[model samples]
Target: MYKVTVYVTYKDSVLDPQGEAVKGAVHRMGYDSVENIRIGKYFEIQVSKDEDDIEQVIEEICDKLLANVVMETYRYDIQEVEI
Candidate 1:
């Protein structure tokens, strides 16, 4: 089996309003040291070992469904799993 961990986030050029709001809240709560924050999505996927071209599959999934290519970017890590 294979385990895939996907992280999707806004591109650096885009503004993250949610993250900014959270940071503002944190600052109000007396956390002045908090400099910046960015919100992102995490996905864990499991694939059978029988699948061919796991990397390609993951790339397509991310590009087509998980992330918006214009505003967001994604990265993934693949690990072999015993179960």
Candidate 2:
């Protein structure tokens, strides 16, 4: 079996309004040292051992579904597992 961890986030050029709002709230709560924040998505996927070309599969999934190519980017980690 294989375990995959995918992280999706906005491109650096994109503005994160939600993150900014949270940062503003934090500042109101007296956390003045907070500089910047960004929001992102995380996904965990399990693939069977019988699957072939795990990298290709992950790339296709990320490119087609998990991330917005125009505004967001993604990265993943894959690990072998007994399950």
- After superposition on all C-alphas, the RMSD of every candidate to the true structure, in Å, is 0.5, 0.7
Which runs of model 1 end up more than 4 angstroms from their true locations? none
Q: What is the lDDT of residue 57 in candidate 1?
A: 98
> Clashes per prediction?
0, 0
Q: What is the overall TM-score of model 2 with all chains considered together? A: 0.96
Candidate 2 pairs with clashing backbones? none
Model 2 residue 66 CA deviation in Å: 0.6
Q: Pick the candidate with the highest lDDT.
A: 1
Worst 10 residues of 2 by lDDT: 74-83
lDDT of 1 by residue, 53-75 (tens): 99999999999999999999999
lDDT of 2 by residue, 7-78 (tens): 999999999999999999999999999999899999999999889999999999999999998999999999
Which residue segments of model 2 deviate by more than 4 Å?
A: none
